[model samples]
Target chain A: MGTRDRIVAAADQVINELGLVRATTREIARAAGCSEALLYKHFSRKEDLFLAVLLERMPALTPAVTRLSGQVGFATVAENLEEFARAAIAFYRRSLPLSAGLLAERSLLEGFRAMLAETGGGPHLPIMMLGTYLRDEQKIGRVGADADPDAAAALLMGACFHRAVLAALVDLGPDDKAPGFVATLMAGLGPR
Target chain B: MGTRDRIVAAADQVINELGLVRATTREIARAAGCSEALLYKHFSRKEDLFLAVLLERMPALTPAVTRLSGQVGFATVAENLEEFARAAIAFYRRSLPLSAGLLAERSLLEGFRAMLAETGGGPHLPIMMLGTYLRDEQKIGRVGADADPDAAAALLMGACFHRAVLAALVDLGPDDKAPGFVATLMAGLGPR
Candidate 1:
């Protein structure tokens, strides 16, 4: 990888380990086997470096969410939900530290808001896509015709995010419990 | 309030405004109008002060939650949900600063975990209370008997918390959309 890429990767590692508060340019330079000047040559500030790291990492999550959405039609709603649940669990497990750090940093939110304005927030984008899918499902009578697709989409996505946060924050064992949680949620909201 | 209480409250305000990293004991003591030594007399460390502030704020949330739950049969589920939604919105609005600060501090999850442990973290308390009302409705054929009370409880509570967090983080408007969100979720999950 290029020096810029290495610096960004090192910043991500440092941020994950020591948190954004303590992830200094010097530490990142050390991690990348470079001088602090070289690090600053690529990024103007620590915040810029952090944003670059987030942008780099976010693309990895998009495909996973897209893949899960594609798998929705292959099985029953409950099964599809279980698949989504598992995917969410895996995604959060990998991204928790960074996600947690970002959530903890208000300045990061400014950067993220700018990124969202530019590229659409990676996490929120999936929910919008899922909203469209849910609208289609409602029209097809797979979901209740009376159901507000936008609201349903928000609920489904919100529930998944909430569950993932809970799992990451609390020590919920990774048995089939998550899948079961998703299944139960699906049952609660499934076609009556 | 006592000097110790003032110090803790000052710490809470500072942390809420400037975040945990930036909120120093000196700043807190200044805000409290007390000497740093006096501040230190009450809490040995920053973590302890933070925890104390959180504990002071935490008790307020539970009583509000319980009060909402008790309103179950006194009003229609929809009516109760609407009232709960409004209360929840107000609660979250007031708590948003604290929530944002906690997230920024990266200590919310830890505090939440501690709180949950002390309060008995299980599906039972919330489930049982809401389930009783749901069950009563189902027995009267208001809700479908096939509905899973546990699942329904999770859905209702989850939707409320999810909407609250979203409202706190994003501008969903002053209409208090939680009721609409909850209503739609209920419609999706309610008796056909």
Candidate 2:
């Protein structure tokens, strides 16, 4: 619709076609039916443009963050956790393969990480949210008193993300493992 | 070493600098102190060279698989699982960053998947082996009978891999979470 949207869309296409290494700004500009100068008017750098594409294209973890925030005390601890994990798993399944294009390119990943660091963010955003929720559960005596919330949160998110990776790379199909996995993960950690 | 090893090492270097997209065969050959013809004689395609690099450079899961095989009947189930997870985590920490190069390129990744298929292997081989070990544990009444060995295996490996990704991308440093995480994971699974 707009030039900016068109440029971003074109960048996405070029990335999908040639991978991140070959998706030059010139190629992206050509795809957008614009001059390179025009493309630079919207974004200062190629990494900036790539960042826009990534943020716009990848599913945001914010909605789940919001849901976890609201469900802190009301739901069963296991229920709250399993649901949160399910949301993460779904997001990873969709984004993992697509995000490979960036992962393969060192500079793009570094730029992305720098951008994250500037924003006081990193990949652990989801883990932190889950940690907060788990801490709340521990406080209220829903989860085990001895359980380390940070480690539990990391373990939960890590497993979900890993499962997503398997689904993407190994043709593992849609996740039928979550319910059992969650139960296995949660079995020993209930209030004692 | 020999020409084959030299070529693969050169590919590793070029890939580290330029990522997969820009690491052309010409560049790799130049770096390897060999003619492109000599390089081709050693490896037919770029993907093959990269695979050789991956196989040589990245940590093989085979040793851990062997360790688990022998430990099935001897060690405490929790101890065995934690050690296996540590090995997986250590491997991921080394390989995850290097893997970004593959994730960036579509054809390269597809080529990789095809190669794995030909070898009757995929990334989840370790998970499957661990699952077998856990099943052995279940049969002997060491772990909970209700636990899904496959899911448990997936969860263990998945969590370790995700943590490695974080360490590489998010500056998460060394993993201080594993001991507590493993404890939480094994809490209810032990024989009473």
Candidate 3:
């Protein structure tokens, strides 16, 4: 890996372990097996280094969300939601340590916000995609057209996100129960 | 307020202003007009201080949600759903800062879990309440008994929570079209 990539990887680990409050540049350098001077050579500041870590990780997340939306078939909605939920849980589980770190470091918000806007994914994309899907389903009479698809999409995505967030906090297991939960959610949102 | 409460209150302001990472014990002590030793005397560590702040704030979140649920009446199911949706939105809005702060801090999870279990609220309460309401409505033939209340609740809660989270991230309004959203979700989840 390049010096910059090595710096980011080490930073991710440090942030995960020590949290943003305690992860100093010197510690990150030691974790990367590089000198502090070398670390500064790649990134001007700690905030810049943290942003690199986020950018490196974000690309991996988008495909997991978008791929499910591309699946074809009504029978697949439950499955799609389940897969998406599992993927989300996995992503957060891995990232939670870093996320907690970033959150603790108040300085990172501006950089994080910039990254989210530039990347076009954070939490909103999934909701919008699901909303659009619900709208289309309504048009086909598969779901009720009279209802607002945006709201429905927002609701379904919200529940899944909330559960995933809670699960991340508690380390809930991923099993067949995930699909069951999604099924229950669908039933709640399905037409009469 | 006692020394402990003063410390916690200071921690809350620091957390809100600086984000969790930047809110150091030194800063908190300075904010509280006390020495670092005094701060430590009151709370074992920074995590303990954070927990104190959350414990102080989380309980007040439920009453608004309960009030919203109670507002639902015998009008069109859509009207009731709209009331629920609005209540959900307001609750989320008020809690967003706290949620964001907690999202940043991993140590707060235990406190959050305890709070949820004790108060019978938190992220899951909305979905569970909506599920029960829908189930009752279904049983009474107000909603089709064949309809799945669990799924409906998930759908409704998910949309509202998702929207609130998104709104916190982006500067979006409350999607004032909740009535339409309710209609669509109910149509899907309602009885044949």
Candidate 4:
């Protein structure tokens, strides 16, 4: 692969092992089989590399969310949401460990928050993106006009996120509960 | 209050400020204005003291949940669930910072898991309690007979949790979104 991709993959592995606060860029560069100078050529800050790992190597929630905008009127609302829920659950589950350290340290959390804010990112992205999708669907009579898109997005995504949080504490096994969650939500979102 | 209550209160404050791992029994005792030996008399272990703080000093979710069983046939299911959601959001928000330490370190998380297992407790209590309430409602035809009570319970509680998680990173302000969330879910929950 390319040097940039290698560096990002190495960052993910080291960060997963040592957490964000403890994982050093030098270790990441060594893991990538490159010099620190070479690593700096591609990404200047550790946060930049971390962001690359998040947006690239983490579960594909952003891409799936991006695709929602295109599927506005093409699919059943329930089906679209079910797909989103599955992706969200997987994403949250994969990313929870990375966040354990960030959330534990006050300064780390503040820096992470600033990094996210600077990039126009944070945990709120999915909610806003999906809310926009729901609003677009509403325009086409595919969704109930009175439905509160943002709140519905929050509820649906929040349920997936909660499942991930619980899974972090215990084994939730192979059972897939997202479909049932989306179906129940669909009962409320149907055009009225 | 009494000495026992004083220790529990001190533990709650200390743990909230310093997290679960770093907040020691000594510090907690000092905060309570008591000796270490006296602190041990009221609570045999720090875990016991932490549990007491969670149950007694945090937001009253346990009591609100216990009250649900008695309201099986009395109130609207939507109203009951909404009340539970508010209590849960408050409870989760309060307990999250305390958990930051437990979840961040591998050994600490393992110890916490063991402690929770020994006490027959973890994060599953609320889901089980609310699910039982829904089942009871179903027996009286207050809820749909075919509804998956556990999934519904998980979704409602998870949404509350997700809201708290977001509020942790960014201010969600004074606006209450729990009611709208419950309203949407209730549309599906109402007995046909």
For every model shown, what is its TM-score relative to the native structure? 0.79, 0.87, 0.73, 0.84
The DockQ assigned to candidate 4 is 0.37
Q: Write the per-residue lDDT of candidate 1 for residues A1-192, one digit (tens) a residue.
A: 999999998988886677665677899899999999988899976656766776575435456557655753455555655565566546655555565555455576556546555653445555567666656555555665666656555555655555555564456565554444544444452224
Native contact recovery (fnat) for each candidate is 0.16, 0.54, 0.44, 0.38
Each predicted complex: what DockQ? 0.33, 0.47, 0.40, 0.37
- Per-chain TM-score, chain A, candidate 1: 0.76
Stretches > 4 Å off in candidate 2: A1-6, A30-35, A188-192, B188-192
Candidate number of the best TM-score: 2
Give the candidates in order of TM-score, highest first.
2, 4, 1, 3
lDDT of 1 at A141: 52
Per-residue error (Å), model 1, residue B179: 2.4
Q: Where in model 1 is the C-alpha error above 4 Å? A: A44-48, A58-60, A69-73, A175-181, A184-192, B40-48, B55-60, B89-144, B156-175, B189-192
Per-residue lDDT for A19-66 in model 2, tens only?
Answer: 777888999999999999999999887868877776676566668778
Backbone clashes counted, model 3: 23
Q: What is the C-alpha lDDT of each candidate?
A: 0.60, 0.74, 0.64, 0.78
Candidate that scores best on lDDT: 4
Model 3 chain A worst lDDT run, 10 consecutive residues? A168-177
- Candidate 3, residue A185: the lDDT equals 45
lDDT of 2 at B81: 70
For candidate 1, report its TM-score.
Answer: 0.79
